[model samples]
Target: MARFVAGYFRSGRIPIRGVHLAVVLTFSLLAVTAHAEFPLPNHGESVIVGGDRAYPPYEFIDKDGKPAGYNVDLTKAIAEVMGIRVEFRFGSWSEMRTALQKKKIDILQGISYSEDRSRTLDFSPPHTIVHHAIFARRETRPVRTLEELRGKKVIVFRDGIMHERLKRMGFDRELILTPTPAEALRLLASGKYDYAVVAMLPGMYLIRELHLSNLVPVAKAVVSEQYCYGVLKGNRELLSRFSEGLAILIKTGQYKEIYNKWLGVNEPPRVTKELAIKYGAAILVPLLVILAVTVLWSRTLHKRVEARTAELAQEVAERNRALEELRRHQDKLIQADKMASLGTLVSGVAHEINNPNGLLLLDIPILKRVHDDADEIFEDRFREHGDFMLGGVPYSEMRAEIPRILQEMQDGAQRIKRIVNDLKDFARRDDAGQKELIDVNAAVQTALRLIDPTIRSSTQHFAATYAEGLPPVLGNAQRIEQVVVNLVLNACQALPGVDRGVSLATGFDREQNVVVIQVRDEGVGIAGEHLPQLMDPFFTTKRDTGGTGLGLSVSAGIVKEHGGTLRFESAPETGTTVTLSLPVPAQRG
Candidate 1:
């Protein structure tokens, strides 16, 4: 009874056996034709089909190098029903469609249904149903009212039903048509389109595929459409067979099973065109308002970022300028310090020479008197009464007067020469003198010996305390001399104008194996506040008196370069002590 009812529906009649045998025969023949399970028509062994390879979830090549998707599955089913092994050729959809019309392929599958499509090919009953929906960014609000979309742009697939619907609603001016559903969705996610009419199922598939949460369905579905497999228009026999096979699949519930497998569950409240229009307006109006607010916020943030960047640049520039100015001032102060030290050295040298030279002048008159007496005796030549004169003459006449005068003159000249040699030794400057091992005590003694003139002129005395068995230190001898000279001169300068002056001391701190030299002076003490800045370049209390301010600074640099330390102690109105600590030579080894 069920088969009869299916036959009646399929053939457009009630099955009455006696009255329409020819009709039953014809219906039966069509039924048999639909089930004709042959390898191919008598002329060929296979069927050819055309498809677009890039279209995913419909007609595409899978990673395993096999054709896969809903269309591939549907084509296989139809081939099974037709009892033919099929081959596929791929190209652009337009090109494929043209090839199909040229009778180059036996069938084309998974094509969206349209009135214009009917002009080119005959279509089987629809295999899948889909709708056109607007996709937009999640930040966008639902477009619910058409009147609110006055200035917004929307995108649609080319030759889509959306174009016709939007034109009818006077929104054609705002429509932007795209070639692919994927492209439209991308633009929608980026906020380029206020609304995009794209394939509803494909859009949903991508949303899940990409795990995209920032996009939303902005407009309601505006139209529902169906997809069908097609054949060229002249292929009536192939179309007839396809229709019959489709009816059998439907009657046997196989079509529903295939649909359910690819598409999943049939959702309740299927979206309609009315719902789409209603929601499109519902979504778009609020979206436009939100977009306006977002644009304003972005502009405000950009301005703040630019402002902060400019402020940072300005601060950096100011800091660089300050550092450069400080460097220049330091260089100037160093030059001034060298000149000041040179002047002090000149005065010390003059005083040192004066002592020896003055002693020689004092001895000169005695030598001249002795020489005159000896010359007078030699001129007389013992001419008068030698024997009688010799008896009466004193032993002083018998003495070797010339030899004694010559001996005294030689001694004075040697003393002067020794002082001059010491000055020369101290003044020798090897311009390329780099770091060398040196006796710390010797360097200190040389500095003081050269400065002895200053000590005498100041009416001051210097005392030294030496450490027994102190080790040599690694350092440049000339540089160490310069440091000692700077310290001793600074001590002299620190002293008040008085008979009592400064003391030079040297020792080793046994536990540290370090050589230490100290200069102590009875002078007006340094103020507490200035002590910390004593070694700072260009920082001086005696600028008004032409103080260069770099004596301590240069001393500090030399000491630091030798891996040593310089320290000092001072009391208000009392005195000051400056100390240097240099590492022992044995430790450096």
Candidate 2:
């Protein structure tokens, strides 16, 4: 019935676009203008954006000799919202690269990222992907791969990704270099070269615009890579702004419009007037019949409704009173049921974990005692045999390592017991634990020992500064250790590579009379707006990486329980510093 009635109204050609279009237009305007006035560095000063002169559609100078292409338009859109003045400099691809190298240009609007280029340049997240193809003239033998071009003459754009790739792969023999993709394709079409390698889109675009009909792309995608904006290495300020602007354009749907205008295959399917007319009557007759039937049914339903109105009203009042009474009882019961179920689950999980940890707790010490008794025997065997393998390491090496490994196991088992205890406490709504006067440095050091493997893999540079003359704070040592582990691991994960560093420091704040532990990382930093919510329950930016958002929130609660505070300070591309402060315990004298 709904389908037929909808068809009937649509057949009359009712214009339902008025409201929908208005809503869409309003949001588009809002999206674009929301950050239109964002202030940029060196505001009002024109930053030179560089691009290739002969690369069509992506970036190029038009017949009027102005920078006008997909890259140009996209850059303009970004500049508008980012509120930066940009001037376009169009030249040979090599010259543009040189300009960027010399710092004469502040941005390269289009460049594919490569490790070789990355040595001297930094990139924003890719905005699009570029596919390179091998081009040959019609009636020539097709080459599917670069190896097929072993003896054939080949042309490639100078200083381009393909050129470097060919050199690295030892396919550089008989290579001819052209200044731009357009010139290379033009040369290949004029039979100046056996084949040319260029970006597929620009090759296709130039063929249509320049009327180079004889040239054809023989291979589809010989090399595909992320196409991005490039800046001189260490120009993070400009890099971040462009990246943010691109994100905004994408979120606003403006990026799709620009992409469709240039690269997107936008040929809309056509509908013929004759075909529409042929099906028009077939659709309309059934719709009219359905409309009549619906009207008759609605009239009968209206009469029936009127007859039951008074009786329904009386029943509704009686039911409402009973329902209100029942709902009150249900709410309380549901709350109790939920709490009971959760407590059971927590207790069950804790016990299940304690089962295995119990073995490590009980068995590891016996293993250690056995190792001690046999150490003398093993030493005699080693002295005579010059060392044999034990558990994949020489017995001499294992002699020292075994004790450390066993001790680590012992520490790990104890930590597991503590964690299980914490879980059981959670189940019973008990945060109570025996407090001790903790040496802030010693507790943090123990936590570091437990997670040393994570820190080693995450970064090459790590520093620990244990400040002296710090008064001990009263708290559960394991809980304090738990908070330190969380903060350090969060720092390690924030680092993008092993080259970045993570540092931890302990200090005394005489003014606040609190001992402070600071964990810092040279990683991608958090945004300022997120700082306040960092300690809020169930809020996280690391959700994609298995973050439940409870780490900081739970750690905050732990610190609060010990009469302390947790604070975060950070910014993009810089790093984050998490400070945990515990107040010094008062004397009872």
- Tens-digit lDDT string for candidate 1 (149-255): 55788876554445655676678789887766666677777768687766656677667676666776665443445456677554546655555556556556776
Q: Write the per-residue lDDT of candidate 2 for residues 1-589, one digit (tens) a residue.
A: 1122222222333222121222233333323323323233475689789999888778888888899878999899999998888999989999999999988888899998776777787666566767778889998999777667778888999999889977876777778998888888888888796999888888888888889999888986666555777887766567667766777787798988998798775222224444555665664465456555655665575556445654565778766565556546654454444444555665776787799889989999999999999999999998887756464233644577678768968986886687567556445543638988989999999999999999999999999999988899999899899899989999998999999999999999999999999999999999989988887655889977656566776687788789899989999889999999999988899
lDDT of each structure?
0.63, 0.76
Model 2 ranges off by over 4 Å: 1-41, 266-589
Q: Each prediction's TM-score against the native?
A: 0.36, 0.41
Taking all chains together, the TM-score of candidate 1 against the true structure is 0.36
Which consecutive 10 residues in model 2 have the weakest lDDT in total? 1-10
Global local distance difference test of model 2: 0.76
